[model samples]
Target: MAKLYFRFGAMGSAKTLNLLAVAHNYRQQRKKVLLIKPQIDLRFGANAITSRAGLTCDADLLVSEKSYFTLKGNDLISHDSLKKDQKNEIVLDNKLDYSCFLVDEAQFLTKELVEALYEITILCNIPVIAYGLKTDFRNFLFEGSKRLLELSDTIEEIKTTCFYCEKKATHNIRLIGEKPVFTGETVDIGADEKYRPCCKMCLHKLKSR
Candidate 1:
């Protein structure tokens, strides 16, 4: 059965780069892959997903709070060609289209959207791989990440080293200059100048008292 996956990490975890590479691999094999992104993440560009490492790709689908997702592509090709057997295994369409779905900057996704994605994975029999930060700079879980944690079939963390120390970074610190800033909107989209991947100890020490 197809699965919904949540792969999360800290600020500089290269998650977007990995997502792009996976999409490329699928397309290279002559398989169709849908690249989805939250409409709120325009840091790179509109309808584009970019990594701090400079990799970039245009998103095939831009999901908003009110947007509804289905198995149809931009070409209006319906995925109704598929059928399920008595054993609950999904039989593919004659063309074997839509190999997978990849989502970038998924932390801004709404809970309803996440549930819809989960349904898409199971009902459509398409694997959905989502990449985003597990928590905000304040160490609070974003709505999308929280829902994914509960609904995802698999959860994984992308590893990165702390900017302040050699420990594996598990926390994200919002910084303005050398000091940490604790108050701000939870969904600030930025790169190295605004956020840092830090260990728990470094985060505790860096936060202003």
Candidate 2:
């Protein structure tokens, strides 16, 4: 049976870069790997999956909040083109040919979709590797991460040290320029400069008056 793997970290933890490398390795071995990204990720472009370290790839699929995800890439392809283009029609026709599935910013996935992904792994026998932050700046678990925690067979923390301490960083605190702030939407998008990774001790100190 295939396993669901959840690899999580705070901001600037190189999760996306790691994901790209995994995809690269699979392709280099002559295996077909499909990359998936949630549509909420606009920091790089809605459809492109990019890492702060500069590695990039065109995600083979984009997942919407209310969409059904099969092991196939049919959900992301345009329907009109599917009708006009014979090549595309054939691609969607037998969509289970993908060897692997990789998702970046997996934290943005909807609860329903995460469950679907879990099923895709269990029944379809495809390994699903998900990368994203476990918690927001407010130190609360994102919906996708929450479900992933409960569903994944293997859970690994992509290790990055706290910017302010030697302890392994598990918290993300948003910073505007240089100041640590406690305000913002749960899923605000920004470059590495806008967020800092911290350990629990530093986060408590910063949060306390």
Candidate 3:
């Protein structure tokens, strides 16, 4: 049976790059893979998933909190592919569509949307690999990440180094102009400019100063 896999990491963990690499591998093997991202993540642009390293790919589905319900049945992916006139249609043998579902920036997904993704694994019998941060800069669980932690068939951590320490980074620190601040909006999005990964000790030290 296909499984739902949640791969989580701190900031700068190369999650999107990993998603793109897996998608590339599937295409190279002549298999269908569906790339998905939340519509809220527009740092790169609508329908685009770009990595810090410059690797980029257009998303097959850009889901919103409200629109994610479309994943039920054959409507969500197949219809969108047709509407976009995408060259690489997800269908196989004129029936099955997308052997795998790969999602990036999954932390933006709503709880209901995460449940829908769960149903896709069971109802569609396809494996789903979702990648995103496990927590916000405040160390609080994102609704989608919380659900994923509870429901995913498998959970994996993508490791990265702390900026100031040798221990594996587990927390994300929000910075403005190189100054770390604990007060701000939870969902402010940016790359290296706004967020940095840190270990528990360094996080404490920075917050204390």
Model 3 TM-score?
0.88
The lDDT of each candidate is 0.81, 0.81, 0.83
What candidate 1 gets wrong by more than 4 Å, as runs, is: 70-96
Give each model a TM-score: 0.86, 0.87, 0.88
Specify the poorest-scoring 10-residue window by lDDT in model 3. Answer: 86-95
Give the backbone clash total of model 2.
0
Best by TM-score: 3
| Cα lDDT, model 2, residue 15 | 96
Q: Which stretches of candidate 2 lie over 4 Å from their true place?
A: 70-93
Give the clashing pairs for model 3: none
Clashes of each: 0, 0, 0
Model 2 agreement with the true structure over 47-140: per-residue lDDT tens digits: 7899888888998888766455433544432333233333222223244667888989999987767887787776678888999889899878
Q: Give the per-residue Cα lDDT of candidate 3 at 73.
A: 32
RMSD (Å) of each candidate, 1 decimal: 7.6, 5.5, 5.6
Give me the candidate number with maximum lDDT.
3
Q: Write the per-residue lDDT of candidate 1 for residues 90-122, one digit (tens) a residue.
A: 223332358898999889887867887787777
Ranked by TM-score, the better of candidates 2 and 3 is 3
